[model samples]
Target: MTEAINDWMAGFEARIADLQRKSADLQQNIAASGATATSPDGGVRVTVGPTGALQDLQLAPSTTRYPPAELAGIIMRVAAEAQREAAHRVAQAFAPVAEGTDAMRMLQEFLPPPPEHVSDAPVDGLPGVDDIDEPPQPSTPPPSPPPPAAPPRPPRRPSTQDDDDFEQPW
Candidate 1:
């Protein structure tokens, strides 16, 4: 009985050491998690950390060609792309320790959904900016109503009986 108990105790200690090593590896992966992404136009670059928080941003001189609002939109799209990639890295880092566990479920819930692109492509079949160069065709005005159907007849003449002057019915 004593020999069996000793063997079981040794196994338990080894399991604990293995768990510690895995924990250390998980910590290193988490610490190293991050991602970078650039805009399609190559005008903006963004980097994000494990939690999808912004870490750095870079703008090329060509970015000035875009108006301020357009430039801002490009930066926003690039940053979101980087953040999404960082979130994916974080998920991968959790795989060794937290996959298929409640912790992974919570982490997934906390991560942002994939980014949605809104520009360049036509929406609902409407022409995008790239699809047309000419100014939009002027909208046609509605036709005028058929010349007011032959003018209304003049007002009827007043009758003397309807007059209120002189206390008479006229």
Candidate 2:
């Protein structure tokens, strides 16, 4: 019985040491992680840390041409992209630690779903203009009838009282 208990204690100590080593590795990987992204126009760049906090932003000289609102929008877009990249890196770092465990499911619940990828190919359900090859010739429309002529006005009557009544002061 004493030998059996000693063996169990040794196994338990080994498992604890292994877990501590893995935890240390995970922390190191997470600390080293970061991500960066740039705007589509390349006027704005953003960097994010492992926890997805903004670490830095850079703007090109050409970014001055953009209006304030547009610049703000570009900055936000680039920052979001950087944050997504950081989240991806953090998830990758956590992968080995969480694999095949309930922690993996819990970690997935905290992470955002992967972004949907857009394809250059036209949507399957909709018809594309390129599919038609040639533009359809429009059918000739019927000529519209001319507008009806205006009705003729009656001829003016000749005045009998004339210019003499115009001189009276009333």
Candidate 3:
């Protein structure tokens, strides 16, 4: 019975370790993945990290031709594009962990797809795939047989001898 419990525990721990490794891999991929987008005329550029936070921005001297409001609009649009692209990369990064699971479906439903044109910037390319992957679930071991009941001792026998080892009533 003890052996059985040990075997079950070992297998459960191995599965847990595998799950942790998968989570780490997914996090590393997400950190490494990001996207950048630029306006068509190259007047505006925006870079976003895996989480869609703006990491960098660049404006060309030619952008001065546009009114301040117009340039702001252009910048906003390009930033949004970069954010969308970053979301796509993040989704890809989650693939190893979430693919074909309900969590992946939720991610696909929430994370926006990358822009149609990769030529917008010099950023890395993203596949047309949608959705991420699954989340981890802990497994429990089957119940083990209860420990065997302790053996019973024989009943005490009455002493028949009047030796020093025996106690006698007065």
Q: Model 3: how far is 4 from its true place, Å?
A: 4.5
Give the distance in Å from residue 117's predicted Cα in candidate 3 to where it truly belongs.
9.3
Model 3 per-residue lDDT tens digits across residues 1-170: 99999999999999999999999998898998888998877789999888889999999997776667667877887898888888878889898888999988898899865545433221122211121132233457779999999999999999897677545664
Cα lDDT tens digits, model 2, 94-120, are: 887788789777776777665444211
Which 10-residue window in model 3 sums to the lowest lDDT?
Answer: 123-132
Clashing pairs in 2: none
- Return the lDDT, model 2, position 38: 78
Global CA lDDT of candidate 3, please? 0.77
lDDT against the true structure, each candidate = 0.76, 0.73, 0.77
Error of 3 at 32 (Å): 2.3
Candidate 1 structure, TM-score to reference: 0.67
User: Per-prediction count of colliding residue pairs?
Assistant: 0, 0, 5
lDDT, residue 68, candidate 3: 77
* Whole-model lDDT, model 1: 0.76
RMSD of 3: 32.9
TM-score of model number 3: 0.59
